[model samples]
Target: MLKAKVGGALPAANEAMMQRAEAAIGDLRQNFKAWLEEEVGKLEALMRTARTSGIEGEAGEALFTCAHDLRGLGSTYEFPIITRIAASLSKLIETPEQRAAAPVALVDAHVGAIRAAILQNVRNDTDPIGKALAEELETRVTKLVGERS
Candidate 1:
């Protein structure tokens, strides 16, 4: 038998596995991004209604309902960030005091965190919920505190 080349097969196999993994990640990122953009549009509309129609009003309720529906959809996709924010914003939508202004900043913070997660590929598997949204709420609360000072 001719001498076999021992190392020759390993590189090709490793490359193929890496390619498969990258492709899978790419698919998740692309699909998740598309879904997130759509969800963001919905969230923006909800916020606008909460601001304009009055979060306590019937219009705000309708918008909140839409947001809740979106949250449910996100849950189906395991998009915990969207789901958590939608839930938190539901309470804010229902409240609609001048205090509701707080969640506006909260929404902004969530947007920033989402952008970061996308860029860094940081998976929130430990909590599986609400870390980004909580950060957002804290940011909003802090902003409100700053405004008062």
Candidate 2:
């Protein structure tokens, strides 16, 4: 019986298989971008509803869920800034207690920031505008939560 060497180069067949898999996934990034944009639109609509209805009960929960989903996907889709902004929004409305008291102005700030970030195509944390926006959101969240506490 022939034994394969450990920690050695991959077998030629295995290497070929890996290459084929990579090729198959070549369009994955493009598809992800399209899907991410669609999801962002849905999130925006949820934000609108939350804004009009006030972020409480079902509306608040929906907004939080959308923000959580976007937060999770942003980094994977090469939008680290989105991840940061979404994280802020998610944190702001994390609990039912928090959601009940969540200010519409604060929620609007967060949602508007997210929409601006996406519409302006801010992908990285290095962008000055993205950085500023993130900081502003963080400050607003801190101030509002502090006032409530």
Candidate 3:
């Protein structure tokens, strides 16, 4: 009798099942893109409200939460540049004190970066314009946060 080796290879039937499952999951990309677009719109709205109403209290917290969520989802949806922009914004408004004292201009800069990245279809971090935009936003945010401290 032949003995099956542990942790060697998947059986033929198991491999075929895995391939079929992968193909089925691949078809969900379009649906995921649609959902991501809707989520981004909601995030944009939240940011606008924070900008107009002043970044404080519930509005500020909501904006921060949205940015954080975007940061996590950006790479998953093939938008690494968005991840970078959102990460910077999240850092800028991480603390309540930071949010309360955050300048409107700084907040607007972050929101604008996010909007531009999405609208321009900047999926890669290495894209020349995307790189510049991410760097500029990160630098400005870092400077502003430093000044606050």
RMSD of each: 13.0, 5.8, 5.8
Give the residue spans of candidate 2 off by over 4 A: 1-26, 146-149
Q: Order the candidates by TM-score, highest first.
A: 3, 2, 1
Candidate 3 has a TM-score of 0.77
Cα-based lDDT for every prediction: 0.55, 0.81, 0.80
lDDT of 3 by residue, 1-149 (tens): 13455656555677778889877867776776776787688877887787677778888888889889988988877788878888888889988998987786877787787778777887877789889878888888888786433
Q: Which pairs of residues collide in candidate 2?
A: none
lDDT per residue for candidate 2 within 1-149, as digits (tens), equals 13444656555677788888877766577887787788788888988887778777788898899899999988877788888988888888988888887777887887788778778888877989889989988888877565333
Tell me the tens digit of each residue's lDDT in model 1 across 53-86: 5544665566667666756765444566556555
Clash counts per candidate, in order, are 0, 0, 0
Best by lDDT: 2
Off by over 4 Å in 1: 1-35, 95-149
Candidate number that wins on lDDT, 1 or 2:
2
